[model samples]
Target: MNEPRSTYPFIARGASAELFDMGGGQALKLFRDSVSDEMIAREADASAHAAACGVPTAAATGQRIWDGRRGIIYPRLEGATLMDWISRNPMRAGWALDRMGEIHAVMHRVDGGTLRSLKQVLATDIAYGPAPDALQRAAIAYLETLPGGDALTHGDFHLGNVMMTPHGMMVIDWSKAAAGHPAADAVRSEMLMRFGIGPSDWVTNLWRDWAARRLRRSHAAASGVSTRDIDAWRPVVALAWLRARDATGRTPAFMRYLDGALKQAGLPFTG
Candidate 1:
């Protein structure tokens, strides 16, 4: 580990923070830079919120500085992230997938657990931008027909976000947390899993199938999301991609999605 022993650090490399291997299996997640304060705080906030809601998670029971940066000291979780485990366990894929759907539903009600720095601003700065008269008309019309139901969105939940532990599994990374439409979050999540699994094969399809079946069984009204729902969020998510808002390694494809989304929503790509 690059970090020193006195600080007792290990490395976890959060999307916005650098994790160091602390002594005796503990870990310290330090800010990569000031730009990461929001992200760093997001982890702390989500972990605490999970505890408050009685969700199982790594106990972030301490704090300290390491590698010339400030961070939280969390009890180092044992075992690989769920993705690692899933890679070698195709036989258990079905049960694992069903478990993920339950996790998603459980997590959706978390208090602002789906909140994010970029998402809240996206609606104001990008999605609802002052467009040409024609574009504005299109968006307004689309919104009128769109469904409205808010829930905690994990912003970027997937198997990778899940950590397998001796006790069970735990969720991590709250930078994408937000309170908003549930399907938007789920669709974005499903897309993230797409690279790992295709539309027809792999765990992505399995999870989607499981989630769809679960939703159908669910009492909550969560059935309208489909290719249509993804198309709905695509223009804005595409703009986010074009602007390099996220490091999801998917800007080109998302922009491609933008054109398709425009066509699906009954408009030509003005940009």
Candidate 2:
């Protein structure tokens, strides 16, 4: 099919050589400023797969070339972001979180019908990929030894990745989709919540404490996982946190958080 003739409104762009626009009556992700073609293609592939699973998303409507970069376009999404709306309606706080949890649960169930795995994602080379072999080996040994579960992981799940609209909540960004233990995803969400926007000091503290307790409870409730197993997985999530920071350069905040994770991993902390 020929690409849409209407120029989409420029909504966003990423370092990976893409400029996204919303003028085609839907959001369009065009890869122009891509750091690498592989990253854009990986995300596009994952987006297609995720859509196949009945996940809410802008359909892969068309493709176009811009500034010598290939671009894939999806229909524009409709609705106010849940995060944005929540600021106006504080009463929906609990409901928003509950809704968030439900979508995530369904997403985890979409793990099947694909060969995606955390190992494969980790193996992908970034500008400063994954971690040293010691980190990967240690993490793999731990994940391997643990009692496993079948679940889909959004790879990168956080408020920033979720959008709320009249239809419902939808997920964006699938560059890191994989099949993995939900607990690991849970742990990562908790880590990124710190990097989130908004939340006054008191409110942030309240949510952090609430989230921590929730995680402890979830870990306790998960079957067949001993304290030692969870402890071992600790490094996996922490290392994954470091991997994210490394993939993107260490922002001031990221560096600070890595210190906490490294301190937990018993590695010499770097900032």
> Tens-digit lDDT track for model 2 on 1-271?
2233556455654444333456646566655453466656666766777778877755465565755557777767766666567668777766676667666666656754464666444333211344666655555554455545556677677666778877888887766666777666666665555543345365665665465445344434433334444454455565555544432322454556656655665554455
Q: Per-residue alpha-carbon lDDT of model 1 for 87-181, expressed as tens digits?
A: 78867655665566666767666555444533454444444553455665555455545554456566667777777678777877656666666
Question: Residue 85 of model 1: what lDDT?
Answer: 80
Q: Please report how far candidate 2 places residue 207 from its true position, in Å.
A: 3.6
Query: Over 4 Å off in model 1, which ranges?
Result: 1-11, 21-26, 113-119, 124-150, 195-235, 245-256
TM-score of model number 2: 0.70
**Model 2 lowest lDDT segment of ten:** 120-129
Residue 262 error, candidate 2, Å: 8.9
Q: Can you tell me which runs of candidate 2 are displaced by over 4 Å?
A: 1-7, 13-24, 32-34, 120-137, 147-150, 195-232, 246-271
**What RMSD, rounded to one decimal, does every model reach?**
5.3, 5.5
User: Considering summed lDDT, which 10 consecutive residues are worst modelled in model 1?
Assistant: 215-224
* lDDT, candidates in the order shown: 0.58, 0.58
Global lDDT of model 2: 0.58
